[model samples]
Target chain A: MLLGAWGIALFLAGWEVVGQTGALGMSCPPLSAVLAVLADPARALLFQRALGATLGAVATGYGLGLVFGVVAAAAGHLLPGMRGGLDRTSSVIHAIPSVALAPLLILSLGRQATPAALAGINTYFILYVATSSGLAGTSPVLRDLMSVLGAGRWMRFVRIDLPAALPTLVSGMRMAAPGALIGAIIGEWFGASRGVGVIILNAMQNFQIPLLWSMVLLTVMISLTLFWLLGAMQLGAARRYR
Target chain B: MPTAVRVAGVSKRFRLDGGADFLALDRVSVSIGAGEFVALLGPSGCGKSTLLRLVAALEEPSEGQVTVAGSAPGELARAHRLGVAFQDHALLPWLDVTANIGLPFRVAGRAVDRARVSALIGLVGLAGFEAAKPRQLSGGMRQRVAIARALVLRPDVLLLDEPFGALDAVTRRQMNIELQRIWSEQGTTTLLVTHDVREALFLADRIVVLSPRPGRVARELVVPFARPRDAAVMRTEAFHRLADELTDALGGGA
Candidate 1:
C-alpha cells in the first residue's frame, strides 16, 4: 500500500511537470490549472448535473447486470445442459465492440437510455464469465462431502458452490465497476446532452484543456475508489471462503 | 448377527484418462453386521478405499452390488442414514466447528439438533472449540470435528476412509483410542479402510486383510479383546502376535 501511494504521487508529479513545461504541446495544462477549473464555484452546477447523470446510469446498469449475470450463472450451474449455450451467447455478445454497439443502442433506446444499456451489456459479460468459472471451481473434496451428507442439488449449490464462488465474483465486480463507467462514458459521446463524457467531448472540440483534464481526473478518481473498495471486499471473501 | 452392510461379489473398474480400464477390486465380498466394527486392511493401492467408496455410494460397482441395512447404498445415503469421514477431513473452511458438525442435519433438511450436536462435540472432547474454524485447529482437532460430524445424525452406517492416515503415529494411536470409546457408545455399524495393521487390530472387532492391487479378501481374524478396551490392550502379547500375522498376510498376498 505504501508503494502504491508512492507510485501515484510520482505519477502526478510527472504529469504536473510535463504540463508546466508545455513539452507535450499547448493542449496539456498544469495540474494546478485543472484543479482550479474543478474548484470554481461558477461551474459547480454544471459538474453536479453531469456527475449525477453519469452515476445514475452506472448504478442502474451495474445493478441490473449483476443480478442478471448471477441468475444466468446459477442457471448454467444448476442445469448442465444450458452451460454450453450460455457460454456461447456471452462470448458472442462480448465479441462486438461497445463503440460499434452505441449507435445501434441510441436508435433503439434513445439518447437518454443508451448509456445505461451499454453499461449493462458490458457488466453482464464480465460478471457472467467470472461467476460461471468460479462456480465450476468448487473443491472436489467438498463436493464429495456434500454428496456423502446426502445434499440435494439445491442444497449443494447454496451451501457449497455459492460461498466457494464468492471471492472470484467479488473480483469480477471490481473489474466490472470500471468497465461500466467506461461504457457509460462512451455512450454519452454519441449524443447525451449532459454527463462528464459530454463535457469532455465539448472541451476537446473547443480546446478547453483544463476542463478536459479536470473531467478525466474526476473519472479516474471514481474508478480508483471503487476498485480499492471491492479489492478489500475480495480479500475478506477469500479469507473466509478459501 | 444381522448384516448391516454387504458388498456381494463386488468388482470396481475405473476408466483412466487414456481410455484404458483399470480394475481396482475383483470379486471382493465382505459383510458388516449391525452394531459391529470392521476394518478392511491392505497395503497402498489394494482397493480397500474403493470398497469403502462403493459401500458409501460414492461409486458404483462395475459388477455385483453393495447394500446397507438390506437396501441399496444409495438409498441409505438418500435417507440420510449414512455418515462418512475421509483422510482429508473435508470440513468446510467457512463454518465453525458446531456448524460443521451440524451439516448433515442441514443437508437432510431436518431441524438443526442443538442438544445432539453439543453432545457429540463433548463426546469428541471438542467442547470448548465449538466456535473455532477448521483452519484454526490442529490436524487432530480437525479429524475430531469430522468424526463428530459423521456421528451427528446417528447414522446407521459410518464409513471411515483412512480417517487417521494423515496424522502422526502418536496422534493416530490416540485417535484410535478415542474412536473406540465413541463407537462403543454409539454402537453404529462401521467399516474402516486402512493400510495400518496396528490400527485395524486396535479398533476393529474383526479385520479383513486384502491383497495388493486388484484387491480381494486374503484373510479374516476376529479380535478377542473385551469391550471398552483401552490403550493397554495394544501392549498385550496377543495384540502384537495378531498384528504380525496380519502383516505377514499382507506381505504374502503382495
Candidate 2:
C-alpha cells in the first residue's frame, strides 16, 4: 500500500515538474492550477457529472461481462465443440480495439447507453476466457472424486468447481475492471456530450491545461477506488481458499 | 454370503496411436462377497488401479461387465452405492476437513449429519482438526479425511486405489491400523489395490496377486490371522511368512 502511494506521488510530481517547466509548445499549468480549477464550484459540478457518467458505464459493462462469461464458461463444459468455437470467437473479439469498435456501436445503437454497453461488451471476452480456463483447469482427480461420491453436475459446480475457480476468476475481474474503465472512457471519447473523457477532449481542444489536469486527476482517483475494491474482493476470496 | 461385486470377463483396452490397441486388463474375473475385505496386490503397471477404477465405474469395461450389489457398477455408482479413495487423497482443497468428510452427504442432497461427521472424524483420529483445509493437513491426515469421506455415505462397496502410497512408512503403518478399525466398525465390502504386500496381507481377508502387463490374478491367498489384529502381528511368524510368500510370488527378492 505504501509503495502504491509512493508510485502515485512520483507520477504527480513528474507531471507537475513537466508542466511547470514549459517543455511543451503551449502554456502547461502546474499542480496548484489543477487544484484551483478543482476547487471552483462550476468546474467541480462538471467534474462530478463526467466522473459519474464514466463510472456508471464502467460498472454496467463490467457487471454484464461477469454474468455472460460465467454462463458461457459453464455452457462450454457441456458442449466441448462449442467451447472451442466460442474460445476462438472471443479471442477474435479481444483482438479488436474497443476504440475502433466504438464508432460502429454508436452507428448502430446511437449514443445513450449503447456506447457504454459496447464498452461492457468489450470487457466480457477477457472475463469469459479467464473463467472458462479456470473451470477447465480443475484436476481430473478432483472431478473423479466428485463423480464417485455421487456429486451431480450442479452440486459439483457449486461445491467444487466454482470455489476452486474463484481465485482465477478474481484475477480475471482485476484485469477486466481496468479494461472496462478504459473501454468506457474510450467509448465516451468518440462521441459523448458529458463524461470525463469528453471534458478532457474539450480541455485539450481549448488548451485549458488546468481543467484537463484536474479531470485527469479525478479519473485516476475513480480508477484507483475501483481497483482497490477488486483487490479487497481478491483478498477475501484468497482467505477462503487458504 | 452373497456376492457383493462380480467382475465377469472384464477387459479394458485403450486406443493407441496408429489405430492400435493397448490391453490393460484382459478378461480378468473376480468375485467379492458382501462384508469382505479383499486386496488386489500387484507390481506397478499391472492394471491394479485400472481394475479398481472399473469396479468404481469411473470407466466402462471394453468387454464383459462388472456388478456391485447385483446391479451394474456404473448404475450403482450413479445411485450413490459406490465410494472410492484414490492414491492421492483427492480431497477438495477449497473445503475444510469436515466439509470434505461430508462431501458424499452434500452430493446426495442430504443435510450433513454433524454428529456422524464428528464421529467419523474421531474414528479417523482427526477429531479437533475439522476446520482445517486439506492443504494444511499432513499427508496421512488427508488420507484419513478421504477414508472418512468414503464411509460417510455408508456405502455398500468401497474401492481404494493405493490410498496410502503417498505416505511415509510410519504414517502408512498408522493408517493401515486405522483402516482396519474403520473397516471392522463399518463392515463395508472393500477392494483395495496396493503395491505394499504387507498392507494387503494386514488388512484384507483375502489378497489377490496380479502379474505385470495384461494384468490377471496369479494367486489368491486367504489370510489366516484373526481379526482385531495390530502392528504387533507384523512381528509374528505367520505374518512374516505371508509377506515373504507374497514377495516371492511377485518375483521380488525375499
Candidate 3:
C-alpha cells in the first residue's frame, strides 16, 4: 500500500516538473497554477456547477443501468429459453462503440438526456455480463440442494443466486464507475449546456491552460473517488458472501 | 404398512459427449417402509447417489420409476415434504446456523417458525453457535447444521447422500452416533447412500449393498440391533462379523 502511494506521488512530481520546466508546449501549466485557478472563488462556483451536473448524470445513469442490467440478466437466467437470445442481443448492442452511439443518442434523447443515456448504456453491458456469469457461477451442489428442498425458481434466485452473485456484481459496478464517467463526459461534448466536459473543450480552444488542466484533474478525481468507493464495497461483499 | 419410498426397477443412463448412452444403473430396486432407515451402500461410481437423486426428484430415471409416499418424487418435493443433505455440508455461507436451519420454512413459503428453528439448533448441539456461519463451524458442526436444515421443515422423507463423507474417520464416527440418536427421536423415513460398511451397519435398520458397473443390488441384510443403539454395539463380535461380511460383498465380484 505504501509503495503504491509512493508511486503515485512520484508520478505527480514528474508531472509538476514537466509543466514547470516548459518541457511540453505552452498548453502545459504547472500544478500550482491549476490549483490556484481552482481555488479562486468565482471559478470555484463554475467548477461546482459543472461537477454537480456531471455527478447528477453519472448517478442517474449508474442507478438505472444497474437495475436494468441485473433484471435483464435474471430474466435470461430464470427463463432458460431466453438465455441464448438475450445473450446474443446484448453482445450485438455492446459491439456498437459508444463513440458511434453519441450522435444517435443525441438525435433521439436531446442534449441534456444524452449524457445520462450514454452513461447508462456503458454501465449496462459491464453489469449485465457480470450478473449473468455470477448467477451461473453459484455451486451446482447448492442448486441441487435447493431443488431437493423443493425451492421454486424465485426462491432459489432470492435466497441463493442473488447473494452468491453479489461479489462479482459489485466488482462489475466498480469497473463500470470509470466507464460511466467517461460516457457522461463524452456525451457532454456533443453540446450539453454546461459541464466539466464543455469547460475543458472551451478552455482547450481558448488556450486557457490552468483551467483546462483543472477540469481534466477534476474529472480524473471524480472517477477515482467513485472507483475507490465501489472497490471497497466489492471487498466487503466478497468477505461476506464467500 | 405403506412403503415410505419405492425405487421400482429404476435405471439411469448418462449421455456421453459422443451421444452414446452409458448405463449407470440397471433395473435397480429398493423399498423403505414408513419410519424406517435404509442405507444404499456401494462402491464409488456405483450410481448409489444417482438412486438417491431419483428419489429426491433431482434426476429422472432413464427407465423405470421412483415413488415416495404413493406418489411421484416431484409431488412430495413440490409439496415441501422432502428433505436432503449432501456429502458436502452445502450450507449457505451468508446465513448463520439458525437462519440456515430456517431456510426450509422460508423456501416453503411458510412463516419462519423461530421456536422450531431454535429447537433444531439445540437438537444439533449447536445452540451456542446459532449466529455462527457455516465457514466458522467445523466439518462435523457444519454437517450437523445441514442435517438440522434438512429436518427443519419436518418433511415426510429425508435423503442423505453421504452426509458425513467429507469428515475424518473419527469425526465421521462421532457424527454417526449423533445422527443415530437424532434419527431415533424423529424417526423420519430416511434413505442414506454411502460407501462405508460400518456407517451403514451402525445407522441403518437395513443395508442394501450395490454392485458397480451397471449398478444392481448385490445383497441386503436386516440389522438385528435394537433401538437407541449405543457405540458399544460396534465393539461386539456380531458387529465385526457383519461389517466384514458387507465389506467382502462390496469387493466387486467381477
Interface RMSD, in order shown: 0.7, 1.5, 0.7
**Over the stretch B16-53, how does candidate 3's per-residue lDDT look in tens digits?**
99999889999998999999999999999999999998
Cα lDDT of model 1 by residue, A1-242, tens digit: 99999998998898899999999998888898999999999999999999999999888999988988988999999999999999899889889999888889999999999889888998998899889989999989889888888888899999999999998998899899999999889989999999989999999999998999999999999898989988999899989998
Q: Which stretches of candidate 2 lie over 4 Å from their true place?
A: A1-11, B17-20, B252-254
Please identify model 1 stretches exceeding 4 Å from their true place: none
How does model 1 score on DockQ? 0.87
Model 1 chain A: ten consecutive residues of lowest lDDT = A144-153
What is the per-residue lDDT of model 3 for residues A1-242, given as tens digits with 9 covering 90 to 100?
99999999998888889889999978887888888888889887898899998999989998888888899999998999999998998888888988798899989999998878888988998999999999999899999988887888999999999999999999999999998899889889899998888898899889898999988888889999999999999999999999
Q: What DockQ class does candidate 3 belong to? A: high
Ranking of models by TM-score: 1, 3, 2
Regarding lDDT, does 1 or 3 come out ahead?
A: 1
Please provide, for model 2 over B1-254, each residue's C-alpha lDDT reduced to its tens digit, 9 standing for 90 to 100.
89999999988998989899989998899899999999999999989899999888788899999888888877777878788889989888778999888888878888999999999999999988989998899999999999888888888899999999999999899899989888889989999999999999999999988887788778889999898788789899989988999999987421
* Candidate 2, A1-242: lDDT as tens digits: 99999998998798678767867634567777788898898767787788788888888878888898878887886567798888887788778777677777788877666547765776688778888878877888988987887777877788777788888888788778767877887778777878888888998999887888888877777777878888999888877854
Ranking by lDDT: 1, 3, 2
| Error at A199, model 2, angstroms | 0.4
Using Cα atoms, each model's DockQ against the true complex is 0.87, 0.70, 0.89
Candidate 1 residues B1-112, lDDT tens each? 9999998999999999999999999999999999999999999999998899899888999999888898888888888989999989999999999999999998999999
Candidate 3 chain A, run of 10 with poorest lDDT: A25-34
